[model samples]
Target: MSQPLSVPESHPRPALIVVMGVSGSGKSTVGAALAKAISRPFIDGDDLHPKSNVEKMSRGQPLTDEDRFPWLAIIRSTAERVCAEQAHSGEVKEGDRPAAVVVCSSLKKIYRDILRGQHAASTKMPAEEDTSEKHPSGAHLPASPALQTYFVFLDGTENLLMDRMSARKGHFMKASMLKSQLATLERPGEGEDGVARIDIDATPEEVEGAVRKAVKDMVGM
Candidate 1:
């Protein structure tokens, strides 16, 4: 166990946390736990996948980048919307932390960059700029604050991941596709911003604890 990270008197709002890993790495489970621990909402990236993509994966086929583009866009928009809602709600005070945890197999650097709002071609609204103010009509608009994105990569041995995937029921992904996912995975480098790596060998509770600590360290929480 690690020492608790200190929470500053004042810190930024709208912490967008992506719990990322290969399938069966416990991303959804750990993401839900982390969200509960941090008092944030959890969004499962699987729910955002298109029907075609789901059907293909169910047949044990791996998704191409083109198949994933729209799905990733949806996830990005969902996170942005959640953060915007938190900013509008009066629940967050000066020092209070507002966050959303999303579970996704963000295996590639380009995918992670899209989630971080760093992609120039992203269709999602800009995080820092308030487009609502620009509109003359007072229709409710989504306006996210400057996002502070964090990645919690749950890494594990191939055998463990395959075992877990085999135990899973009613999922579109097949255990046999684990190799493809591992091949696609691009571990965050030392210079990458706001990334934390956790060994999946730990119990779910312990993993969640580590995730919370890593997020706190990332956001000065």
Candidate 2:
């Protein structure tokens, strides 16, 4: 195992992590592993998607932005609540700590902006479909916490993802929709913030190790 990254004393607040990528990219598995290593709560982004959306995907339909809007709202609200509540009370539930490790595809930059708004309302980040000329920070939410937000992008070739989807069983999403997902996928670029993009070329263990190391290094854990 690689050594954990050491956090700087001046860093503020626990990280709000989003394990993101297209379906079959192992967001849940890797996110859970990262949460375990960091000792934080893991909130699966899949759980936040509405039943209707799941049904549509299962039926091999690509979701329109309209279909994703409400689901994204729920994600943003939950994240906001998590950060704001902890910042207010400084106490975690039961034996848990204050940090949250959330896993969501967060495909579009606009989707991420919506989540950022939840962290601080003063930053009026654009809505998912609101891909106007304005940047994410252009709209500010002051109420949002200043805590660091980390995003992990699980990446692989289309063939690899398709093969994994075919091998997996009983998932709410169907293999038929894999192509649609691939078509809709938006890979992370260098300009995105708090993003740790991992290319999955080796074993799952290796991918998990890279993610763990990225988080530790990014957050100075």
- Top candidate when judged by lDDT against the true structure: 1
lDDT (10s digit) by residue, model 2, range 53-86: 7779889787877676556555554554454455
Give per-residue CA lDDT, model 1, range 1-221, as digits (tens): 11212223363556778999998988888889888877778998877665667789889786877767556665665666565556556445665676779999899998887677655354343344332432222212222335667899999999998878778877766755788788878989988888999998887778878877887787655
The TM-score of candidate 2 is 0.70
The global Cα lDDT (0 to 1) of model 2 is 0.66
Candidate lDDT values, in order: 0.71, 0.66
Candidate 2 ranges with C-alpha deviation above 4 Å:
1-11, 50-62, 84-97, 118-147
Q: RMSD, each candidate, Å?
A: 8.5, 9.4
